[model samples]
Target: MSAPSTDLTQEKQRFELLSQEFENSQKDYSKFIAARQQLEAQLQENKIVQDEFALLKSDAKIYKLTGPVLLPQDKAEATLNVDKRLEFIRGEIKRAETQIADCQKSLESKREELLTLRMKIQGV
Candidate 1:
Protein backbone atom coordinates (compact mmCIF):
# COMPACT_ATOMS: atom_id res chain seq x y z
CA MET A 1 0.00 0.00 0.00
CA SER A 2 0.94 3.71 -0.15
CA ALA A 3 1.55 3.77 3.60
CA PRO A 4 4.11 0.96 3.43
CA SER A 5 5.80 2.65 0.44
CA THR A 6 6.04 5.92 2.36
CA ASP A 7 7.55 4.21 5.38
CA LEU A 8 10.10 2.47 3.14
CA THR A 9 11.08 5.74 1.56
CA GLN A 10 11.53 7.42 4.91
CA GLU A 11 13.58 4.56 6.20
CA LYS A 12 15.74 4.68 3.10
CA GLN A 13 16.35 8.36 3.58
CA ARG A 14 17.21 7.85 7.21
CA PHE A 15 19.67 5.14 6.26
CA GLU A 16 21.26 7.39 3.64
CA LEU A 17 21.71 10.18 6.15
CA LEU A 18 23.19 7.82 8.67
CA SER A 19 25.57 6.49 6.05
CA GLN A 20 26.73 9.98 5.22
CA GLU A 21 27.26 10.79 8.85
CA PHE A 22 29.22 7.58 9.33
CA GLU A 23 31.45 8.48 6.42
CA ASN A 24 32.05 11.94 7.82
CA SER A 25 32.89 10.51 11.19
CA GLN A 26 35.31 8.09 9.57
CA LYS A 27 37.07 10.94 7.84
CA ASP A 28 37.30 12.87 11.05
CA TYR A 29 38.70 9.84 12.81
CA SER A 30 41.36 9.50 10.15
CA LYS A 31 42.33 13.11 10.61
CA PHE A 32 42.56 12.62 14.35
CA ILE A 33 44.80 9.62 13.83
CA ALA A 34 47.04 11.58 11.51
CA ALA A 35 47.31 14.39 14.02
CA ARG A 36 48.17 11.95 16.76
CA GLN A 37 50.86 10.41 14.60
CA GLN A 38 52.36 13.80 13.87
CA LEU A 39 52.41 14.64 17.55
CA GLU A 40 54.03 11.35 18.40
CA ALA A 41 56.71 11.89 15.78
CA GLN A 42 57.40 15.35 17.12
CA LEU A 43 57.59 14.00 20.65
CA GLN A 44 60.09 11.39 19.57
CA GLU A 45 62.24 13.97 17.80
CA ASN A 46 62.14 16.17 20.87
CA LYS A 47 63.17 13.25 23.03
CA ILE A 48 66.15 12.60 20.82
CA VAL A 49 67.11 16.25 20.93
CA GLN A 50 66.71 16.26 24.69
CA ASP A 51 68.93 13.22 25.01
CA GLU A 52 71.62 14.81 22.89
CA PHE A 53 71.41 17.92 25.00
CA ALA A 54 71.72 15.92 28.17
CA LEU A 55 74.85 14.30 26.85
CA LEU A 56 76.28 17.71 26.00
CA LYS A 57 75.45 18.93 29.48
CA SER A 58 77.15 15.96 31.04
CA ASP A 59 80.25 16.52 28.96
CA ALA A 60 80.32 20.18 29.87
CA LYS A 61 79.86 19.39 33.54
CA ILE A 62 82.67 16.88 33.48
CA TYR A 63 84.98 19.32 31.77
CA LYS A 64 84.10 22.24 34.01
CA LEU A 65 83.71 20.52 37.35
CA THR A 66 86.07 17.55 37.17
CA GLY A 67 88.47 17.92 34.27
CA PRO A 68 91.37 20.31 33.78
CA VAL A 69 90.98 24.07 33.34
CA LEU A 70 91.66 23.67 29.63
CA LEU A 71 87.98 24.13 28.79
CA PRO A 72 87.76 26.92 26.21
CA GLN A 73 85.37 29.87 26.10
CA ASP A 74 83.63 28.42 23.03
CA LYS A 75 82.84 25.22 24.96
CA ALA A 76 81.16 27.27 27.68
CA GLU A 77 79.14 29.14 25.10
CA ALA A 78 78.15 25.91 23.39
CA THR A 79 77.06 24.44 26.73
CA LEU A 80 74.78 27.39 27.39
CA ASN A 81 73.31 27.06 23.92
CA VAL A 82 72.69 23.36 24.45
CA ASP A 83 70.98 24.05 27.75
CA LYS A 84 68.64 26.55 26.12
CA ARG A 85 67.87 24.16 23.29
CA LEU A 86 67.14 21.37 25.78
CA GLU A 87 64.67 23.54 27.61
CA PHE A 88 62.97 24.50 24.40
CA ILE A 89 62.75 20.89 23.25
CA ARG A 90 61.33 19.84 26.58
CA GLY A 91 58.62 22.45 26.28
CA GLU A 92 57.87 21.31 22.76
CA ILE A 93 57.59 17.69 23.91
CA LYS A 94 55.13 18.68 26.59
CA ARG A 95 52.98 20.54 24.10
CA ALA A 96 53.07 17.62 21.69
CA GLU A 97 52.03 15.22 24.44
CA THR A 98 49.06 17.40 25.25
CA GLN A 99 48.09 17.53 21.60
CA ILE A 100 48.37 13.74 21.33
CA ALA A 101 46.13 13.33 24.34
CA ASP A 102 43.54 15.65 22.86
CA CYS A 103 43.58 13.77 19.57
CA GLN A 104 43.16 10.46 21.37
CA LYS A 105 40.20 11.81 23.28
CA SER A 106 38.59 13.10 20.11
CA LEU A 107 39.14 9.80 18.33
CA GLU A 108 37.62 7.88 21.23
CA SER A 109 34.55 10.11 21.33
CA LYS A 110 34.03 9.79 17.60
CA ARG A 111 34.35 6.01 17.77
CA GLU A 112 31.80 5.87 20.55
CA GLU A 113 29.41 8.06 18.61
CA LEU A 114 29.84 5.90 15.52
CA LEU A 115 29.18 2.77 17.53
CA THR A 116 26.04 4.21 19.03
CA LEU A 117 24.82 5.29 15.66
CA ARG A 118 25.43 1.85 14.23
CA MET A 119 23.56 0.27 17.08
CA LYS A 120 20.64 2.59 16.60
CA ILE A 121 20.59 1.87 12.90
CA GLN A 122 20.59 -1.83 13.59
CA GLY A 123 17.66 -1.41 15.97
CA VAL A 124 19.74 -2.84 18.74
Candidate 2:
Protein backbone atom coordinates (compact mmCIF):
# COMPACT_ATOMS: atom_id res chain seq x y z
CA MET A 1 0.00 0.00 0.00
CA SER A 2 2.92 2.36 0.86
CA ALA A 3 5.36 3.83 -1.71
CA PRO A 4 8.37 1.88 -0.34
CA SER A 5 6.48 -1.41 -0.40
CA THR A 6 5.35 -0.80 -3.95
CA ASP A 7 8.93 0.00 -5.04
CA LEU A 8 10.17 -3.17 -3.32
CA THR A 9 7.55 -5.28 -5.03
CA GLN A 10 8.50 -3.83 -8.41
CA GLU A 11 12.17 -4.53 -7.77
CA LYS A 12 11.37 -8.11 -6.80
CA GLN A 13 9.44 -8.62 -10.03
CA ARG A 14 12.30 -7.15 -12.04
CA PHE A 15 14.73 -9.51 -10.30
CA GLU A 16 12.55 -12.49 -11.09
CA LEU A 17 12.35 -11.53 -14.75
CA LEU A 18 16.12 -10.99 -14.91
CA SER A 19 16.74 -14.35 -13.25
CA GLN A 20 14.64 -16.08 -15.87
CA GLU A 21 16.46 -14.25 -18.65
CA PHE A 22 19.84 -15.22 -17.22
CA GLU A 23 18.80 -18.87 -17.07
CA ASN A 24 17.68 -18.80 -20.71
CA SER A 25 20.92 -17.13 -21.81
CA GLN A 26 22.91 -19.80 -19.96
CA LYS A 27 21.01 -22.52 -21.79
CA ASP A 28 21.62 -20.86 -25.15
CA TYR A 29 25.34 -20.49 -24.39
CA SER A 30 25.56 -24.18 -23.53
CA LYS A 31 23.83 -25.20 -26.77
CA PHE A 32 26.18 -23.01 -28.80
CA ILE A 33 29.21 -24.55 -27.08
CA ALA A 34 28.02 -28.05 -27.94
CA ALA A 35 27.36 -27.06 -31.56
CA ARG A 36 30.81 -25.50 -31.84
CA GLN A 37 32.45 -28.62 -30.45
CA GLN A 38 30.62 -30.82 -32.92
CA LEU A 39 31.55 -28.53 -35.78
CA GLU A 40 35.20 -28.58 -34.75
CA ALA A 41 35.14 -32.36 -34.74
CA GLN A 42 33.63 -32.40 -38.21
CA LEU A 43 36.24 -29.89 -39.42
CA GLN A 44 39.01 -32.11 -38.12
CA GLU A 45 37.57 -35.17 -39.81
CA ASN A 46 37.14 -33.35 -43.10
CA LYS A 47 40.70 -32.06 -42.98
CA ILE A 48 41.93 -35.57 -42.47
CA VAL A 49 39.93 -36.74 -45.44
CA GLN A 50 41.40 -33.95 -47.56
CA ASP A 51 44.89 -34.96 -46.51
CA GLU A 52 44.23 -38.58 -47.42
CA PHE A 53 42.85 -37.50 -50.75
CA ALA A 54 46.00 -35.53 -51.46
CA LEU A 55 48.14 -38.61 -50.89
CA LEU A 56 46.13 -40.74 -53.27
CA LYS A 57 47.20 -41.18 -56.88
CA SER A 58 45.11 -39.46 -59.54
CA ASP A 59 44.12 -42.83 -60.95
CA ALA A 60 43.27 -44.29 -57.54
CA LYS A 61 39.84 -45.84 -57.30
CA ILE A 62 37.32 -44.26 -54.93
CA TYR A 63 34.29 -45.92 -53.46
CA LYS A 64 31.51 -44.00 -51.76
CA LEU A 65 29.50 -45.79 -49.10
CA THR A 66 25.86 -45.29 -49.98
CA GLY A 67 23.64 -46.92 -47.41
CA PRO A 68 24.77 -50.56 -47.25
CA VAL A 69 26.63 -50.47 -50.56
CA LEU A 70 30.06 -49.25 -51.60
CA LEU A 71 29.36 -47.57 -54.93
CA PRO A 72 32.30 -46.86 -57.20
CA GLN A 73 33.03 -43.17 -57.49
CA ASP A 74 35.42 -40.97 -59.44
CA LYS A 75 38.38 -39.77 -57.32
CA ALA A 76 38.03 -36.24 -58.66
CA GLU A 77 34.33 -36.13 -57.79
CA ALA A 78 34.99 -37.44 -54.33
CA THR A 79 37.72 -34.86 -53.81
CA LEU A 80 35.41 -32.08 -54.96
CA ASN A 81 32.65 -33.27 -52.66
CA VAL A 82 35.04 -33.32 -49.71
CA ASP A 83 36.28 -29.82 -50.53
CA LYS A 84 32.73 -28.48 -50.69
CA ARG A 85 31.84 -30.17 -47.42
CA LEU A 86 34.94 -28.66 -45.79
CA GLU A 87 33.91 -25.20 -46.93
CA PHE A 88 30.39 -25.68 -45.61
CA ILE A 89 31.63 -26.99 -42.27
CA ARG A 90 34.06 -24.07 -41.90
CA GLY A 91 31.22 -21.61 -42.48
CA GLU A 92 29.07 -23.40 -39.90
CA ILE A 93 31.93 -23.23 -37.39
CA LYS A 94 32.21 -19.49 -37.85
CA ARG A 95 28.46 -19.09 -37.37
CA ALA A 96 28.49 -21.21 -34.24
CA GLU A 97 31.42 -19.21 -32.86
CA THR A 98 29.55 -15.98 -33.44
CA GLN A 99 26.46 -17.33 -31.72
CA ILE A 100 28.58 -18.50 -28.79
CA ALA A 101 30.22 -15.10 -28.38
CA ASP A 102 26.89 -13.32 -28.54
CA CYS A 103 25.34 -15.67 -25.99
CA GLN A 104 28.34 -15.24 -23.67
CA LYS A 105 28.03 -11.47 -23.83
CA SER A 106 24.31 -11.66 -23.15
CA LEU A 107 24.87 -13.92 -20.15
CA GLU A 108 27.46 -11.56 -18.70
CA SER A 109 25.20 -8.55 -19.16
CA LYS A 110 22.27 -10.36 -17.60
CA ARG A 111 24.39 -11.47 -14.64
CA GLU A 112 25.49 -7.90 -13.94
CA GLU A 113 21.93 -6.68 -14.23
CA LEU A 114 20.67 -9.39 -11.91
CA LEU A 115 23.34 -8.58 -9.33
CA THR A 116 22.51 -4.91 -9.39
CA LEU A 117 18.79 -5.67 -9.07
CA ARG A 118 19.45 -7.97 -6.12
CA MET A 119 21.34 -5.19 -4.33
CA LYS A 120 18.51 -2.79 -5.03
CA ILE A 121 15.95 -5.25 -3.69
CA GLN A 122 18.00 -5.85 -0.51
CA GLY A 123 18.37 -2.12 0.05
CA VAL A 124 14.61 -1.71 -0.27
Candidate 3:
Protein backbone atom coordinates (compact mmCIF):
# COMPACT_ATOMS: atom_id res chain seq x y z
CA MET A 1 0.00 0.00 0.00
CA SER A 2 3.09 2.27 0.04
CA ALA A 3 3.65 4.85 -2.71
CA PRO A 4 7.11 3.47 -3.43
CA SER A 5 5.73 -0.07 -3.88
CA THR A 6 3.08 1.20 -6.34
CA ASP A 7 5.68 3.12 -8.33
CA LEU A 8 7.94 0.09 -8.41
CA THR A 9 5.08 -2.08 -9.68
CA GLN A 10 4.26 0.39 -12.45
CA GLU A 11 7.89 0.62 -13.49
CA LYS A 12 8.17 -3.15 -13.65
CA GLN A 13 5.09 -3.34 -15.87
CA ARG A 14 6.45 -0.72 -18.21
CA PHE A 15 9.81 -2.47 -18.41
CA GLU A 16 8.12 -5.77 -19.23
CA LEU A 17 6.04 -4.16 -21.97
CA LEU A 18 9.10 -2.53 -23.51
CA SER A 19 10.96 -5.82 -23.42
CA GLN A 20 8.13 -7.57 -25.27
CA GLU A 21 7.99 -4.80 -27.88
CA PHE A 22 11.74 -5.06 -28.45
CA GLU A 23 11.45 -8.81 -28.89
CA ASN A 24 8.66 -8.36 -31.48
CA SER A 25 10.73 -5.84 -33.39
CA GLN A 26 13.59 -8.33 -33.55
CA LYS A 27 11.26 -10.92 -35.04
CA ASP A 28 10.07 -8.43 -37.63
CA TYR A 29 13.67 -7.70 -38.57
CA SER A 30 14.31 -11.38 -39.14
CA LYS A 31 11.23 -11.68 -41.36
CA PHE A 32 12.24 -8.70 -43.43
CA ILE A 33 15.73 -10.13 -43.95
CA ALA A 34 14.33 -13.43 -45.10
CA ALA A 35 11.88 -11.78 -47.47
CA ARG A 36 14.63 -9.66 -48.99
CA GLN A 37 16.84 -12.68 -49.49
CA GLN A 38 14.06 -14.56 -51.24
CA LEU A 39 13.37 -11.63 -53.50
CA GLU A 40 17.05 -11.36 -54.45
CA ALA A 41 17.13 -15.03 -55.29
CA GLN A 42 14.12 -14.63 -57.55
CA LEU A 43 15.71 -11.64 -59.22
CA GLN A 44 18.87 -13.61 -59.91
CA GLU A 45 16.94 -16.48 -61.41
CA ASN A 46 15.00 -14.15 -63.68
CA LYS A 47 18.24 -12.54 -64.85
CA ILE A 48 19.54 -15.93 -65.79
CA VAL A 49 16.39 -16.63 -67.73
CA GLN A 50 16.81 -13.39 -69.62
CA ASP A 51 20.38 -14.31 -70.53
CA GLU A 52 19.35 -17.74 -71.80
CA PHE A 53 16.53 -16.27 -73.81
CA ALA A 54 18.95 -13.92 -75.52
CA LEU A 55 21.09 -16.83 -76.64
CA LEU A 56 18.29 -18.69 -78.42
CA LYS A 57 18.21 -18.91 -82.24
CA SER A 58 15.89 -16.55 -84.05
CA ASP A 59 13.64 -19.40 -85.23
CA ALA A 60 13.71 -21.34 -81.98
CA LYS A 61 10.38 -22.87 -80.98
CA ILE A 62 8.58 -21.78 -77.83
CA TYR A 63 5.74 -23.55 -76.10
CA LYS A 64 3.54 -22.84 -73.09
CA LEU A 65 2.12 -25.68 -71.04
CA THR A 66 -1.56 -25.57 -70.27
CA GLY A 67 -2.68 -28.57 -68.24
CA PRO A 68 -0.73 -31.29 -70.08
CA VAL A 69 -0.96 -29.55 -73.46
CA LEU A 70 2.03 -27.79 -75.01
CA LEU A 71 0.61 -24.79 -76.85
CA PRO A 72 2.95 -23.35 -79.47
CA GLN A 73 3.94 -19.74 -78.81
CA ASP A 74 5.65 -17.15 -80.96
CA LYS A 75 9.24 -16.29 -80.10
CA ALA A 76 8.31 -12.64 -79.84
CA GLU A 77 5.55 -13.39 -77.38
CA ALA A 78 7.83 -15.57 -75.30
CA THR A 79 10.42 -12.83 -75.22
CA LEU A 80 7.81 -10.33 -74.12
CA ASN A 81 6.66 -12.66 -71.35
CA VAL A 82 10.20 -13.06 -70.07
CA ASP A 83 10.77 -9.34 -70.20
CA LYS A 84 7.60 -8.67 -68.24
CA ARG A 85 8.49 -11.27 -65.64
CA LEU A 86 11.95 -9.78 -65.24
CA GLU A 87 10.47 -6.34 -64.78
CA PHE A 88 8.06 -7.61 -62.14
CA ILE A 89 10.81 -9.44 -60.29
CA ARG A 90 12.98 -6.36 -60.28
CA GLY A 91 10.14 -4.32 -58.82
CA GLU A 92 9.53 -6.93 -56.12
CA ILE A 93 13.20 -6.91 -55.18
CA LYS A 94 13.20 -3.15 -54.86
CA ARG A 95 10.08 -3.25 -52.72
CA ALA A 96 11.54 -5.95 -50.51
CA GLU A 97 14.77 -4.01 -50.06
CA THR A 98 12.83 -0.91 -49.11
CA GLN A 99 10.85 -2.89 -46.57
CA ILE A 100 14.06 -4.29 -45.12
CA ALA A 101 15.48 -0.82 -44.76
CA ASP A 102 12.34 0.39 -43.05
CA CYS A 103 12.40 -2.58 -40.71
CA GLN A 104 16.01 -1.83 -39.79
CA LYS A 105 15.14 1.73 -38.98
CA SER A 106 12.23 0.64 -36.84
CA LEU A 107 14.38 -1.90 -35.01
CA GLU A 108 16.98 0.74 -34.31
CA SER A 109 14.34 3.06 -32.88
CA LYS A 110 12.89 0.28 -30.74
CA ARG A 111 16.36 -0.57 -29.45
CA GLU A 112 16.92 3.04 -28.42
CA GLU A 113 13.55 3.19 -26.74
CA LEU A 114 14.23 -0.07 -24.93
CA LEU A 115 17.55 1.26 -23.71
CA THR A 116 15.94 4.44 -22.45
CA LEU A 117 13.23 2.46 -20.69
CA ARG A 118 15.78 0.21 -19.05
CA MET A 119 17.67 3.22 -17.80
CA LYS A 120 14.49 4.73 -16.39
CA ILE A 121 13.62 1.48 -14.65
CA GLN A 122 17.07 1.32 -13.14
CA GLY A 123 16.82 4.88 -11.90
CA VAL A 124 13.51 4.11 -10.33
Best by lDDT: 2
Q: In candidate 2, how many Å is residue 74 off?
A: 0.7
Residue lDDT tens for model 1, 1-124: 8996776676666667756765775676576567656656665765675466566643454233336555544455655755676576566657656765665676566567656656655667
Q: Rate the local accuracy (lDDT) of all candidates.
A: 0.61, 0.92, 0.82
lDDT score at residue 93, model 2, on the 0-100 scale: 92
Greater-lDDT candidate between 2 and 3:
2
Better of 2 and 3 by TM-score: 2
Clashing residue pairs in candidate 3, if any?
none
Which candidate would rank higher by TM-score, 1 or 2?
2
The per-residue C-alpha lDDT of model 3 at residue 64 equals 85
- Candidate 1 to truth, TM: 0.51
lDDT of 2: 0.92
Best by TM-score: 2
Give per-residue CA lDDT, model 2, range 1-124, as digits (tens).
5998999999899999989989988888889999999999999999999999999999999999999999999999999999999999999999998999898888889899998988898884
Clashes found in each candidate (C-alpha, N, C closer than 3 A): 0, 0, 0
Answer with 1 or 2, whichever has the higher lDDT: 2
What are the candidates' C-alpha RMSDs?
A: 8.4, 1.2, 2.1
